[model samples]
Target: MRKCLSALLAALAFIPGCAPEGTGDLDVQWTVGLTGSCAQANLGFVAARLETLSGTLLARRDAPCDAHAVRFRDLPVGSYRVRLSAFDGDGVEAYAATVSDLSVQEGIEAASCLARLTPRPGTISLSWYFQGGRLCSAYGVEDVLLSLFSADIEILAQSFRCDRGAAVLEGLLPGSYEVRLDAVDAWGVPSHSFAAGNLLLRPGHELSFDAELTPCQGPCW
Candidate 1:
């Protein structure tokens, strides 16, 4: 009888005394824009990861970018970190952003998370000139229209009223670009045209180019 009682006591000790507290829910939404020049159709997935304050991963959820939201349920009440990422159709990460010190409470929902992401950028400085002095001196070609294009012929950036014979294009992604400039007369009509192509820009790098315009005798098309 004594041996049986001791064995029963040992077995009861191994069992848990009480159930764990109920978990909470975490809802996250990205309020900011994504990085890269890819189209939305190329974006394959959006992912969110929850981790403890000490960097212990707790849960992860992935959904389509068009799903509009992400939720992690049954999370213990504590502080955590959330990371968000957008992946392309080829499984390549196009953009990533994170939020820290998120608090979750028992039986309560924690929402209102916002993450902002920015792509790597480069710079382009362009200066314009005319082959004949008549375009600038006689016609007074002070206002110019400038357009920047990607290698695939996509319009990446543009500017109007570019004065001082110079224009600066900023926050451009690293790639090959082409420059197109049109001189505007007092009546806002295009009088001259110039083009510079195959300019390479790297991340955090600056590129400078010169555009020499020729007078349009007939119609500036």
Candidate 2:
């Protein structure tokens, strides 16, 4: 019957619409900052990726570390997140950076110029509480302020929920630093605090510790 044949033709024509057509390219560039040059940092290769805003992988390409750049061809036209990662000879990821809201248009090359990639992140997992047998929740503690200092200069700071029990920080540069913790209340005030010296972090590594905060009593800002 002609009607059945026509229906089959119509279904065949609609099949291509199921997938996005590739009509774009991307050029991603970066410098190794947290550890200096690729050779100095012992990086051997780099990998680039284009992902959707929701973190869906679209395309990936690998290049020599020193290339300092990678191009992605035949990408779909849409907003994407660009990520560049570098690895050492031992296959450990040593540096990385991500740029979001990068728009890839049809038939033109889009450039992402992130000045430098950070050294492979080191992680610090902290389990915290007050010294005088007080749990974070029982004492009206709302947030925990964890900060890192090198040579008495503040390096990084992050806030975690008090009741979260434990928090992991994966944004530290490889170095020895001091660690500080503050138990803060609903009014952005610290009522208990603790500090320790000689916290060491290394690239592609993790450190874990417990913190006991003594009552600051007053003016513990």
Candidate 3:
């Protein structure tokens, strides 16, 4: 799903006192970059991480998407960075930002800000046809199942009517994927198949795949 945009500007501030010995406290507030709200962009939550200046992770948490301020209490005094990421309903990152060079002092409150996250994700549109025709009647096929594989693991599976011939997948991570298509007959038997390997997906772009499915000879017969 493609969404519209709204700019969210984050702010940074620091206050003195109210911390335990040899430690500090942190508070973070942020909002989604695009659309009216996170819900409008189909984003559920924000992934927040506290890390050292040298890339050592300190603490991480998931915050609400509604611009709620999250509290990180009792942090060791040090210099660190804060990273924020918001994900879509399917756990795909839809918004992200990294803020660095934060210095936390003992017995003080560190307030942080974040840069605007660009809404960037990929989409895949697939269309399939049988050797005989586009109608799928000649092959007795009633359904086509589409499965997407990432790193040799099945990430998604969806079924569509054979006659439909096309479907669109959205909010995909940028990477290499394998697309598998199976045509099933009236009795739920697989009658034809097609596969395309190493399909590349880029950020903020749409990839299209059109393929012809051959009859399952020895296996189906």
In terms of TM-score, which candidate is strongest? 2
Query: Would you estimate the TM-scores of all the predictions?
Result: 0.44, 0.52, 0.49
Selected candidate, larger lDDT, 1 vs 3: 3
Rank candidates by TM-score, best first: 2, 3, 1
> Which residue pairs come into collision in candidate 3?
5-35
Q: Which one wins by TM-score: 1 or 3?
A: 3
2 or 3, which is superior by TM-score? 2
Per-residue alpha-carbon lDDT of model 2 for 67-168, expressed as tens digits? 888887776655678888888777878778898777555665564456477777788887877765646777879998988889899978889888876778
What does candidate 3's lDDT look like per residue over 1-221, in tens digits? 01111011011113334322377677777765644477776778888888876688888988777764576787765556788887777777767778776655576556455456556778999889877679898888899988999998999999999998899999898779999888998888898999889998854567997889998766742
Global lDDT of each candidate:
0.68, 0.77, 0.75
Off by over 4 Å in 1: 1-22, 32-41, 120-221
Span of ten consecutive residues with least summed lDDT in model 2: 2-11
Model 2's number of clashes is: 0
Residues 1-221 of candidate 1: C-alpha lDDT, one tens digit per residue:
53454345445545697323456788887633544333532556778888865687888899877665798887754556888877766575555678887755576546457666333476898787777543364666657877778865757545455457787788778678888778887777888888778898754467887778887879876
